[model samples]
Target: MGRSRSRPVRLVASDIDGTLLGDDAAAARFRSTWEALAEGERPLLIYNSARSSEDILSLVDANLLPAPDYVIGGVGTMMTEGRMRTRMEAFIEELGPALDPAAIAAIIGSIEGAILQVAADQNPHKASWHLHDAEQERIHDIAARLRSAGLDVKLIYSSRRDIDILPRTGGKGSALAWICRELAVDLDEVVVAGDTGNDLEMFEMPLVRGVVVANALAELCRVVAQDRRHYLARASHADGVIEGLRHLGVVR
Candidate 1:
C-alpha cells in the first residue's frame, strides 16, 4: 500500500468527466457538497481533464462547477491561469515542439477503424481518435506498428472507443506531479479521484493516492483495483468522490 501522508490533507485534484460530472444528479450533488464544506476547511481544488481551457471556462460560466483553482487541460498537454489567452499561449510554449498533428492524422487516417475527433479535442501533446473497430487485438497491432516506426507516443483507450495518443512525457499523473512541484504542494497531502482509462495514469504514481469511483469503466478497475494507494469506492460519480474523501478522512 502507498504510505499515508504524515501531514493533514490540504488539496483535492480530480478529473472532470465520468469522475466528477457523470450525470445531472451527480453533478448537482457534488456542487452542493462543495458548497457545504467549511470555508476554513476548504481544500484547494484543481481540475484535470481532457477538455480545452475554453470549454472548461464555458462550464464555469454555465455554473456547472465552481471556478477551479487551476486547470490541467488537453489530457495534460495544456495548463492555463483562468481563461486568459496569454496563459494558453504560455502553455503551448512550455510544451515545446511535438509530433505534428497532420502526421498523426495521416497515420490514423490510414487505419480504417480509426476516426479523428474534433479539432478542439486535439493538442500538441495529444492526438485524439475514436475507433470504429473497437477490437482490442486490432488496436494493439496498430499501437505496435506505431512503436516500431519510432513515433514514441503512448496510446490510451477508454470506454471501448475513445483513443488518445499522448506524448511520452504527457499524462494526468505526470501533470499532477508537475503541478505539485509548481505549487509547492506536498504529494502526500493531495487526493485525486477519477473514473476511467485516462485516469489510470493518476493511480500509478506512489505520490497520488487515487480514488476510483464506482461508475468507473470495468477495464480500469480490472487493471488498477489491486494497486497500492488506489481506493475503489461503491458510490458512483460525485457521491463517490465524497465517499473517497471520507475514506481518506480529508473531508467530513
Candidate 2:
C-alpha cells in the first residue's frame, strides 16, 4: 500500500512494545527488516519506550536487536547515549535543580492510594491500567496534585498500559528534539513509527514525520490521519512497521 525505495535514511525512531515486538510474528519481521538495512546506510535507531532503561537494555541483550545509538527510557524522562544514567542525573544535567524528585514523589504518594486502587481493580496484576479511560482522569488528578505541590508534572499518554509522569517541561518529544539537535539532523529528516498514544508527541513535532502502523489504536489512527504526510499502513505490528519504513524509502 506504499512505495519502496533505496534511499539512505539518517535516523529512525521507533516505539517498542506494541509497535515492534508485540508478538513473535511481529518481532521476527521487525528483526529481519532491521537486519536488511545496509551497514553504511543503517540509520541510528532511537529506541523509545516506556520501559525503564534497565529493562529495555535487558530486552535488547536477550533478543539481540541491534543496540540503539540512543535509548529514551522512562517514557523519555531519562535518556542514555550508549548506556543509561540515573533519572536524577538526567534531570539535574538537563533542566537543573528546579525539578524536585522529593516533591514529585510526595505528589505521587498523595494520590497513590486512589491510583493503585483503581489500577488493581482494573487489573489484578496492574497490567491493563493504562487501557482504562478512568486512568486519564487519574492522570489529570495527579497532575493537579503535583501543581498544587509547586511541582510541574506532565502526564504523557504513551501506550495503553502506561502513562509517563515527567517534569512539566519535558517528555518523549523533548528528548527527540534534544537528540536531533545533538546530531545536527533536521527534524524533517527523522521518521517516527509507533503503534500507541505515547508516540503522539513525537508526531506533533514540527520537523518530524510520523507513521502510525496499522495495528495502532483507533485514537492513534485519528491522530495520524490528521497529518498529510503521516501514513496508516495496511499491515500490522512489525510487518506494519516495515511497511511504513519502506514507505519512507528507508528500505529497498
Candidate 3:
C-alpha cells in the first residue's frame, strides 16, 4: 500500500459505484484501505457520488467504506455533513422559487413516458427507467426542447443508466469548489477520482488534480487525455484506486 511521504492529503474525494467499488473483491479491498486510513490519520474522505445522500450513506454503512466526513450527492445539488433532511431543506430555500417541487416533478413526469419506452425496448428485466445509450441521446434532445420552451435545465449523464436533470447552474464541480472554499484547502491540494461521465466536472477543474479509473467511458478517456497531468489507472475498481493513489504519491 502507498502512503504520502511529503505532503499528506488533506482531503480525498472519490466516486463510489464504478471507481471504488465494482465487485465483491473491489469492495473488500476498498473497505480495507478506507479502514486503514480512517484510524488516527483522520484525513477527510468526502464521498462525491451521483447517488442521493440517503443511498450513499446506506452503501457506506453496508460496505463499511470510511465514514464520510462529507457527501456531495444528487450530482452535487445536495451536500450533507451528516443528515440530509436539514441540509436539503436549506438547499431548497437557497434554490428559492426557481426549484419548486412541482416544476421538478413536471420535468420528471414529462420524461417518464420516454424513459419507460426505452426501458421496455432495451432492459425488460429492469422495471425502473434508467438511462442507456439511446435514452441519453434522447435526454439531450429533451433538454434542448425544454430550453426552447423557456425552461433552463441541464441533463447530466452520470452512469450509463443514470441521468440527472437539474438547474443549468449547478453540478459536482460547483459543489467541489464550494467545499474547497469552506475548508480553506487550496483546490490544488485536493484530488478527485472517478469512473463515469458524472465525474467529468470534478476532473475538469483547473485547480484540482484528478484520476480517471480504468472503468471510465471512452468519452471520459478522451477528456482525460486532453489533460496530461490528470492520471488514468491501468487497474479497475479498487485496484485502480490504489494505482491512482500511488500515482499521486498518496500510497505506494
- Model 1: CA > 4 A from native: 1-6, 82-91
Global lDDT of model 3: 0.67
* Model 1: per-residue Cα lDDT over 1-252, one tens digit each: 333454666778889888888777878877777878886888778788888867876787888876677788878787766534235455455555786677677677788877889988886688899985377888787788778777878787877888888877677887777878777888878888888778788777676677899989887898888776778888898889878877777666
Q: Which of candidates 1 and 2 reaches a greater TM-score?
A: 1
- How well is each residue in 1-252 modelled by candidate 3, as lDDT tens digits? 234343556777888888777866876876777667535664577888766777778887786565777887767766788533235355434332444334444555576443532322211111123546645467678667667666666667645666565665566787777777878878778888888877888888875777788878775777787786577788888788877777776654
Ordered list by TM-score, greatest first = 1, 2, 3
lDDT of 2 by residue, 1-252 (tens): 556332345888888877877777777767777877777778888888776566677777876456677887766666777444333354336733344544554655454332322422221101112323536666677667767877655666544445445665466777788778878888878888888777888888885777787778865787779777677888877778888887887776
**For model 2, where is the 10-residue window of minimal lDDT?**
120-129
Candidates' lDDT values, in order?
A: 0.78, 0.67, 0.67
Identify the runs in model 2 with alpha carbons over 4 angstroms from their true place. Answer: 1-8, 83-92, 98-113, 116-131, 135-141, 158-161
- Clash pairs, model 1 backbone: none
Please give each candidate's TM-score: 0.88, 0.80, 0.79
Candidate 2 Cα deviation (angstroms), residue 162: 3.2
Query: What is candidate 3's TM-score against the reference?
Result: 0.79
Q: Candidate 2 at residue 13, lDDT?
A: 86
